[model samples]
Target: MRQRIILDVDTGVDDSLALLYLLASPDAEIAGIASTAGNVPAAQVAINNLAWLELARAPEIEVALGAADPLEIPLRTTEDTHGPHGVGYAELPTPIRRISTRSAAQMWVDLVRRHPGELVGLCTGPLTNLALALREEPDLPRLLRRLVIMGGAFNHPGNTTPTTEWNIHVDPEAAKVVFDAFSFAPPDRRPIVCALDITESIEMRPTHLIRLAERAGSHPIETVSPADPPEARSVASNPIIRHLTDAVRFYFDFHDGYDLGYLAHMHDPFAAAVALDPALARTRPATVDIELEGALTRATTVADWAGIWGRPPNADIVVGTDPVRFFDRMIARIGDHARALYPGQPVGDPVTRLR
Candidate 1:
């Protein structure tokens, strides 16, 4: 049974990677994509989403635009992290199709309502769209089969701030709303948070990129200009892998600044993987709260790991992952997709085969 899923994203580098991973997964079926404001503005996020779908040749997936700003705070975009256009060095052709007429919040409500207990909600951005959906449909927590989110930093230092992760930090108010809403639901139905503790464990190095490129065969990277015709833009050599390679180079450079070496953590992809197969990571139940008033700890996710809070566990927080097996699955799925795209080309083995 293919897992039905709706992806909500800010369309940054890692978010784009997550989209590709889903497109490749045989067990997952993307119902739609909802663009939100996080790593970039909602409009740019929509543009990135449309361009990616076009590049993937996935015209069936519809995209809808969400919030332009957080519930209370002004929108903050991380163009420094993801290049000016959200995707790094690689420039995607202008999308021929427009976004869905329905807003992201409306799409979320409609899809879940239509699918009932079959929809899995995967969010890789700020919680604004989900929060808004909850406002429209209060029973959203119970309606979803599961909600997998890529955010929060429990016991580890954050990439955005000392206390808060980027997604939660961008809109703590919306995070608070989501956490509070889910607290009232059953533990099994609550959100499965792929926090930094687990996501930061899986890293992709240059060797992995080389393996991906090799699987894509010896295709020359071509740059498309605005004057180029649609067919010319579409016939690029291994466009998906080439774009991924080009964008990841920027991310690798960013990680180098933090002395994290030449590898970048597979944050969003791990979340998407866990969503497809819950057994990929080990999770523990915990009561999560977003700090709203702390001067230094605002937006921080407070997990009651030791039951000090005395409140029942409201969320399942990922704590562990087998990096080797995870990478194997990732590489295999990517290799499979690359082979499907270029059937005549011989795709060599991935960096590592599934164990």
Candidate 2:
């Protein structure tokens, strides 16, 4: 059975991979994509979504524009971390497809209502759009079959701040609204939280990229390094491999700059995998909440694992996963899909849109 899913993302480099992962998965059906402001502006996010879909030769999927800013605070984007356009050095062709006339919030409400208990929600960006959708349809937590969120940092040092994760830090108010609203969901349906604690461990090294390219049957099996010149880009033989090489190369550069080695913490794609098969991750039930008032801990995610507050668990926080298993699965699916799309390909053909 194909699982129907709606992806809400900021389209960061990792988010791009997550989208491609879903596109490659045989049993996953992308119902729609919501572009939220985070890694870049909402407009560019929407463009990234369309461009990726076009690159993957995927079926027409509805793309919707989300709010320009968060619920309360001004928008904050991580261009330095994800590159100016959110896709690193890879230049995707402009998509001919247009966005849906409806807003992202409306799209969520309509999709869930239309599918009832058949839809699964996957969010890989700030909670802004989901927060907005909740305002119009408060019963969203009950309508969907499951929800998987790639945000928050529990017991892990924050990547954005000493105590905050990037997505939640972008809009703490929106995060709070989402966590609180979903508190009413049934325990079995608690949102699966893929916090930084587990996601940062799903690292993507240069070797993994090489494996992916090799599996795709792309010639020259590209490899990258921190010692390489900053301006270097991929000149791989396959179009998808070339683009992915360039995109992830930028990510590798960013991590090396932070002394985290030339590897990327693939946060979103892991969440996408968990959305497809929860067995990919081991989770713990917890009463999750967002911190909005702390001067040093604002946007921090606090999980009460021991029922200290006596509240029902609103989230199933991911705690463990075998990184090897995930990397193998990713390489197999994406590499096979790319090979089928552009078998024995040459260097990226003068970038152009599909007819």
* Global lDDT scores for all candidate models: 0.83, 0.91
Which lDDT value does model 1 have at 37?
97
RMSD per prediction, one decimal?
A: 5.6, 3.8
Give lDDT tens digits, candidate 2, residues 1-355: 8899999999989999999999999999999999999999999999999999998899999999999999998999999999999999888998999999999999999999998899999999998999999999999999999999999999999999998999999999999999999899988778999999999999999989888887887766667887667577676666788889888989989998999988999999999999999999999999999888898999999999999999999999999999999999999999999999988654333332111
lDDT of 1 by residue, 32-103 (tens): 899999998999999999998888777488899998999999988888888788876667889987999999
Our tally of clashes for model 2 stands at: 0
Query: What is the overall TM-score of model 2 with all chains considered together?
Result: 0.96
Show pairs that collide, candidate 1.
none
TM-score of every candidate: 0.91, 0.96
lDDT of 2 at 334: 95
- Candidate number with greatest TM-score: 2
Candidate 1 has what TM-score? 0.91
